[model samples]
Target chain A: MDGITVLIISNNIVLEKDIEMSADSKEKQLIKKAKMGDENSFESLILGCQGRAYNIALQYLKNEDDALDALQESFIKIFRSLKTFNGDSKFDTWVYRIVVNTCNDMLRKNNSRKNTDSIYWNDGEKEAVLEIPDSSNAPEDLYDKKEKRDHILSCLEKLNPEQKEIIILRDIHGFTYEEISEILNCSIGTVKSRINRSRLRLRETLLEQS
Target chain B: MKCDKTREMLSLYIDKMLDDNLKKEIEEHISTCNLCKKEYDDIMEIVTHLNEVEMVSVPKSFEHRLKNALQHERSKISDSKIIAISDKKKNKLRMLTSIAAIFAVGLISVGLYQDIIGGVTDQLDGTAQLAQDQVMQERVMNNETESDLYNSKLYKSNLDEAIDEKQKFEIKLDVADDVQSSDALKPRMSIYGYTDDNSEPGSTKALVPENYVDNPSVDGDSDGYSKDYSTMMTSEEFSRALTIQAIERNVAAVQFYKGLIEDNLRDFNYEILESDFVQAGECRFRIYIFNSKEGYVFNEEIIAIGKDGEIEFIYTNEFMGL
Candidate 1:
């Protein structure tokens, strides 16, 4: 989950140029049917968002099982309460809000259990014996690159959950301020303020680590 | 803008949420103000790192699990609709109808409006739909409550006969006599119903579900068996069948639902209650009671057995008063 997020988020640089609203006419039609208790329609409506939902949960939980658990929980809830979506807001935002809530629920539950804090490097076992020979740089340079990547991730998990979500949503996911506000259920002003504050916190953490 | 004002506006300007004029003004201020400029550089670096954060691919199994869960919820909803047809109790039917109506009201405008709105769907158009409905109806009918339905008798079982006339289905009437669940808006008046405590979780004994019996293997096992629950029927092990699946399915469905609608109820333990078989027309079902096993609130979960004997959560309503 750690390295995977970097791969996907780095490639999603199209956010600046992509301005299409959440659901297309076809999706909107499906959404309508889904709201009418059509399971097939509901499945179609959620098909696209599932990947993003998984990504968000992965970023939040940093554990694969927890991420999937959050997603399963969120989708079930979404299906149950599809009736609550009144088209007042974008469907994507509604889905994002529920994903956030589900992640929060998982976090709260896991925190309550308080059994152990296990740091899992996803697929670490398979990658541990890797031999990467880059054409552009020496192995030492690549090692430094890997180190820096890990360092950034290490700093990320240090922030509190609110700061973590704000950074991920705004900077990594490149969601618009308005969209983030809707997702977080905050005002545009709050989104801006919080993003800045989160950025400030991350900066401090990186500086301290350095 | 003053330095303090400029500091706050910097974020908005960078995010493009601010006007051009203000952005220019802030840009000018940062040009003259080295301290502010350094602060902005630090913030920009943080944003760069944030953007580098990777996107993880969902594991192959995630889709598998999600589809399974959706199928599970679909079955539950379909089960609920069947309950509407099978349960002649006016109060219970009213509750189910309102639940359906509430969902419709919450949705933005939708089509197929007539089928699921106002009343139970009596004549669903498709064969698949009718087949499924008929299957559910048959299950409910097998519960052996046919005579009671004809006599206009309540859902009073021998559990009721053994206790007393006043104590039929005593759990709701007795244990539910408390403040309504915090989620319910209206304060509910308690009507004492059935209450029999079966708090010991059988998760210890039925380590594997009763229906999940071993299938004879092709000489793979010394016991010549491998665990398979593909075909589970209620009539085989009626009591064991309903309680286990009901507990598992209800918990999973509720957790899924609680996540979707943003409920803040903390995770609580589930206590299995006694189950009874009841029938109406073509549908036969086992009604199971699963209250909050311990601590926090007076919520009661009632689930039912489907035609194939799979379990589905009906509703979790609170009884108030006292």
Candidate 2:
């Protein structure tokens, strides 16, 4: 049993290393082929990141139909714009930014603009700028995790588009702040501040709802 | 640090984004600060809840529809690029023809065009035409008797076919690549055919010639020339005029011209035949017919280096008795 466990673990590490290197080299080859007007390589390249991109769009556009529509629109854009992809950064980061930008554009055009009210407090004034209705449940009373999980998605909807994207990228996608910064085309400092504000706002929303 | 300031950085502390010293400072401040601690706990709960939120599942119908749309989109893109390349090629040919027309106009202005029209028919009187295969064969491996075997009607059809199949200009059959210094490339004769950059679909690109420049970069004005190829002037004057316009002015050698030629002109060996002024139509040409076969066999080509250094016309023919 011990020998088998060690073999499996060692195999996993090697496999993981292969996956990382393979994914990178594969992407480079795919980008080159796709740029030269190879639709097969282009299809494979887009499909590689298709799942995450669709999920990101889903997080932004809530409706299942809209999410798929947004994803299709982004792919069309990426198809047309493949030649302009100079390969300055990871293909995934570039794709993420495109998907995110497309989602934002859709949001703007739909004008289903969520009120991005950021709360602030002063020592003299006894209020959060954006008020949260009081809740009886304490912050620690989140043990019924599944129910709270549903509330979080609803709360995510309430946060502004920027805040929601940062939260989704960080908490759900579990991307590092640096990765988030690169994908968002912003500094790590901006990513940090945005996530902090977003988390606080989301926490306030969750507390009031519960 | 103040409670508010520490609270601002509380999330970074959780994310391990804060430097250790700053993190320690925040931890210590929050240790004494209950309100900041409570705020920190609340934010932590939010993050925890979010992490548990299941990844939005992609609907099956959506996935199917997207793939279908993508297939259509992919084909559309490929078709457009293929179209773009072909369109660019057609444009390139038109551009070359325009340059040739301008060169012809220049010849006309100098009274050379009238002389060319008068003398061309008389120059090749008995040899009215030859079949394309017979012509190609005569220039290469075939004997002269093949021309007498074919009728005039067959020759005319063959001529139509040759024109329809993008008429060949200069055909260089180089046996080996011999690299020479870029500076060695002066007034050497060769042809350039503008082509699609994707030589072999997804092959590597040749190192961009730092020294290999084109018309705009070399001499600034490509169309600026003293005179056309065939002139009333002496042969030496004609060569001198070409040498001055193409060589002295530092004209750029053409890059890949699609199906015509590949690789730099500097890589090939060239022999300068005793060139003389000749005319086919209204166009005047410096007929370069060399009997010496350095590598294999060479043919009768009307060579004219444009003022832009572009080998505008490099068509070959097997004149019966050149």
Q: Which candidate wins on DockQ?
A: 2
What is the lDDT, from 0 to 100, of the residue B288 in candidate 1?
35
Clashing pairs in 2: B193-B257, B194-B257, B194-B258, B195-B258
TM-score of 1: 0.48
Q: Evaluated with lDDT, which candidate comes out highest? A: 2
Segments in model 1 whose C-alpha atoms lie over 4 Å from true places: A1-23, A115-149, B1-3, B88-322
For candidate 2, give the lDDT of residue A101.
83
Q: DockQ for each of the predicted structures, in order?
A: 0.18, 0.27
lDDT (0-100) at residue B160 of candidate 1? 26
* Residues B202-270 of candidate 2: C-alpha lDDT, one tens digit per residue: 333222233232211232121222122123443345446555543321211222122122111221233
In candidate 1, what are the lDDT values of residues B1-322, reduced to their tens digit? Answer: 6788887776677777778788888999999998789878877755666677677777887777777888887899788667643542443354446546545543422232232332212221232254435444654876645432322212223222222211111222223332232113122212213222243321112111111112212222212111221122212343354456445444433333323212112233334444333342112222333222221233444443332222344554321100
> After TM-score superposition, what is the CA distance of residue B312 in candidate 1 from its true location, in Å?
27
Measured against the true chain A, the candidates' chain A TM-scores are 0.74, 0.77
